[model samples]
Target: MQDVIIVGGSFAGLTAAMQLGRARRKVTVFDTGLNRNRYADHAHNIFGHDGTPPGELLAAARQQVQAYPTVQLVPAKAQLVSGGPDDFRVTTTDGETVSGRRLILSYGIVDDFPAIPGFAQCWGKTVIHCPFCHGYEVAGTRWGLVYSSPMSLHGAVLYANWTDDITLFLDGHAIIDEERHKLEKRGVRLVDGKLRTISHDAGRIASVTMDDGTEIALEALYAHPRNRPSADLHEQLELDMGDTPTGTMIKAGDMQATSRPGIYVAGDLATGMHSVTFASNTGSLAAMGALQSMLV
Candidate 1:
């Protein structure tokens, strides 16, 4: 049995592997090669490698981690996860099986895009999320926020950190006059009616078309679609779930340990504050926790 079987091989998984690898522990990472930020062009706010493509950063990390000899990155989805804690077993779709003493579930999440035309295509480009991650580049450009919940009001206010030219699309969500006044006071324009579609040129926003046929020109449209784990390993394992501001996540605690002992979780699956830095930090924590748990 391997020392650890990490269910995902993206930032969190790779980071965890590196730590465990340094400790001379056997680690196997299963990956489907689809990272949440794979669509993003340049990953910002990442220290040292600021503005590097997400894929490139991960590629370099994988290369470094694999050099440890004790770690293997398997390019396959973990089809079935059975057993638990020190006797955990994982099977790939092709029926290959591997058992590890500990598990790390960092499969990440998937964004639930609205049915607005041209929206999903523009993800990671003109239409985006996380202003702190993509904002500096577009600061001073026309920005639009697709209101999803009351939490969006917080986004509208927080966005002043980047740009003042902001429009909060009602998108069929109701807002009280007090909220509207506060938005207006911040120089935010409120667009009424449900969204019809988004017009874009190769992921570059052109304008947002409304149900009433009104069109608002925008450079970037920010959306907070609810997110969920990209895989079902957590559920199949019956790990406890948690809620984030924008969606559901796997509940994690000290050292990034999950509700199930020997099952550690990190990155977007375990936290709402999604970012590369946070992913790396949590990943190291989980690795240390798992390593310590393995002590006799």
Candidate 2:
């Protein structure tokens, strides 16, 4: 049996495998290669490697990790997870089963895109979620915010750091008078009504059309759509879960240990705040936790 089997090889899984590999522990990583950031042209805010293409960074990391003889990287989707503790069993899309003493769930989340046309097309370019990820590129330009949840009210506050020209689309969600007045005082233009479409040229957004056919031109639009775990393997394992502002995540402790023994979680699957640095950090923690447990 392998020392550890990690699901989701994008960021967290790969990092976990690297840590375990360095310690000469046998590790297997399953990846389907569908990264959430695949739509983004370049990733930012990562120290030293900032502005690197997301795919390039992952590819390099995968190559380096595979250099370890104890590490095996498989290009397959983990379909089901069973067993528990030091005897966890994982069945993949290959119809083959792999067992390991410890399990690390690093599968990321999936964003539920809006039905608005051109939204997905412009997702990473003109339509974005994290300002820290794509803010600097469009700073000092016409910016728009789609109020998806109460948590979104603070988006204008955050955007104010990068640009003064900001418009918040209530999009059928009610805003309290107090908060509304605060936004107005901050020079934020608030627009009501739901979004019907996003007009773009070559994946660059030009304007957003409201349900009533009102068109608002914008350089960039920010949205926080609800997301769920990319795969249901966590559910199949029946690990404890918790809800975040945007969606749900698997529950893990300080060491990345799930409520269930021998099972760990890391990266976006365990935290609401996502970044490449955070993913690698949590992955290392999960690996160390599992490694330390094996000694007992």
Candidate 3:
């Protein structure tokens, strides 16, 4: 059996593999390679490699991990997960079964965008998320926020710092009276009604169409998507999940160990805030933790 089986070979999984490989522990990383940011043209806010494409970063990371002889990288989705607690097993989509003394799940989250026609097509482009990641590029442009939850107001406020031309689309959701006042005070226009669609050219959103046959000219739109963890392997393993203000996450400790013995989690699955840097760090931490646990 491998010393550790790291599910998901994105930033987090690779980071973990590097740490374990350096320690002379055998590691296998399984990845489907559908990272959420795959569509983004250039990743921002990440130091040292600012403006790098997500693919480039991953390719470089894969090369570095390959430099370690003890680490094995497998490009396949985890289809089934079974066993547990120092003797866990996982089956990949291609029907390959793998067993390990420890499991580190760095599988990222899944994002579903609004059904608005052009919205999905514009993702990672004119329509986006994460101000710190993409805010500066479109700063001071005509910006719109599609309200999906009450918490989305917080995103809108942050976007305002980068652009004065900001509008909040209720999108058939109720906007609290007090919140409405605050939005107006900040010069954020309020649009109410069901969103019909978005219009764009070459991946750039140009306007937002409402159900009332009114179109709001816009340069970029912000949305908060409902994200679900990619692998449901947790259900098969019956692992404990912790509650967070936003949603539920795989239960893990300071070192990323799960409640089940020898099971660990990293990246978005184990944490709330999603950042590329955070995922990379957590992956490495989980790898080191698993290696240490094996020694004991």
lDDT values for all models: 0.92, 0.92, 0.87
Q: What lDDT score goes with residue 66 in model 2?
A: 95
Candidate 2: list runs displaced more than 4 Å. none
lDDT of 2 by residue, 1-296 (tens): 99999999988889899999999999989999988899999999987889999999999999999999999999999998899777889999889899999999998999999888899899998899899999999999999999988878888988999999999999999988999999999999999999999999988989999988899999999988899999998888788999999999999986999988999999999998988889989999999999999999
Local accuracy of candidate 3 as per-residue lDDT tens digits, 98-174: 88999999888888776779888999998887788888988989999888776788877878789999999998889
| lDDT comparing candidate 3 with the true structure | 0.87
Model 3: worst 10 consecutive residues (lDDT sum) = 242-251
TM-score of each: 0.98, 0.98, 0.96
Q: Can you write out model 1's per-residue Cα lDDT over 64-101, one digit (the tens) per residue?
A: 99999999999998989999778999999989999999
Checking candidate 1 for backbone clashes, the offending pairs are none
The parts of candidate 3 lying over 4 Å away from their true place are: 242-247
